[model samples]
Target: MREHPNVIAVQDALDAAGAHTADDAPSLVVILDEGAHTAAAAAEALCIEVGQIANSLIFDADGEPLLVLTSGAHRVDTAKVAAALGITKLRRATPEFVRTHTGQAIGGVAPLGHPKPVRTLVDTALAGFRDVWAAGGVPQAVFPITYAELVRVTDGTPTDVA
Candidate 1:
């Protein structure tokens, strides 16, 4: 599991950024026995609140890649996000665009470790959780991180995305 390139990249990026969980432990990625293709599934697998799963959503914002780390409990209000970013358009990115910008597939995209840094927004709603779980470069892989750590590691702006 550690040998996977995407997992390696995510781990390296987490290490390089000095990310940590709410308990002050180093953030470590773990591969689940079952694949977690959605936040509800991830929450079910981990036995945690669905709101604790940070859904890494990629979007096309006026032709640029935008990453939104939103709480699984709520849907992203694209209109509000577009207004917040002062962009005329903001929509879900295609699978190709997601891969091209994030270097990982849609269901497994992590907040960091992209070929380049995509503009990111961390939902302020995520701050409600003590520890948030994000994809670790694959559908069955995930990692625990604090909201502050997520924002710091991704250099993401905290926004009310829901």
Candidate 2:
């Protein structure tokens, strides 16, 4: 499972960016015994608060792919985000569009392991947690990272997404 192509890509991207957990440990992707298709499920599996899950969401920002790493406990306020970004139209991306740009399925897009660099916004809400968990390019895999590291690694702007 660790060698899964998607996981490998995620790990390679993490390494290249020097991503680390809150404790300064190297971020290593781990495959859960069961697939965590949602943030609730992932938090339950990892025995952590739902807010600690950094839900990787893909959105269509006026025709371009946009990534938002928001906290599981908060729903993304698209209108607010769009207004803040000065985007004419910001809506949820279709599954096909998400897969096309992220090279990963809807439920498992990592922050940094994409086919191309999508414009990203890290939710300011996520900074409250010491260690946030993110998808590892697949539904069954995840990795731990700090809020600062996540923003830095993805070159994402810190924004209030909710």
Candidate 3:
């Protein structure tokens, strides 16, 4: 199957950022047989633990887009996050808001390829996994990455999101 335009964008972004994936990686964008829109689905498809799946969640922080790369095994403590970032408000972005910020739907929001850079936070819990899977700009697509590489590629601050 041909790559989706969004998937291509993610590939280009990774290339430009010099992000490294497994040399023998199946594909820059791995198309799953079943939809991997949720962390549980992605984990099952990738045959990895749920904790290894990095969920790219976008939030509305006082009208600004904030990308939060959280671990599948945990839920983000919005209050804690706001306190950490010293922000007054941090709420989950709506579907429309997510699309506007990412140019992709909620389920497939990648860390990169946004119209512009959005402040990002990478969950420190992901450090426990050797390889983490992130959405590849489409529900059926995903890519492998490491916690450090994810932070570097997205220029995300590492923090305890749970």
Q: 132 in model 2: Cα distance from truth in Å?
A: 0.4
Using Cα atoms with residue i matched to residue i, what is each candidate's TM-score against the true structure? 0.98, 0.98, 0.94
The per-prediction CA RMSD against the true structure, in angstroms, equals 0.7, 0.7, 1.8
Model 3 scores worst on lDDT over the 10 consecutive residues at 20-29
Worst 10 residues of 1 by lDDT: 1-10
Those runs of model 1 whose alpha carbons end farther than 4 Å from true positions after fitting are none
Better of 2 and 3 by TM-score: 2
Write down the lDDT of every candidate, Cα atoms only. Answer: 0.94, 0.93, 0.88
lDDT of 1 by residue, 68-145 (tens): 999999999999999978999899999999999999998999999899999999999999999999999988889999
lDDT of 2 at 42: 99
- Residue-level lDDT tens digits of model 3 in 60-86: 999999999999998999999999888
**Candidate 1 local Cα displacement, residue 35, angstroms:** 1.3
Model 3 CA RMSD to the hidden true structure, in angstroms:
1.8
Query: What lDDT tens digits, residue by residue, belong to model 2 across residues 11-112?
Result: 999999888997889999989998999999999999999999999999999999999999999899999999998999999999999999999998888997
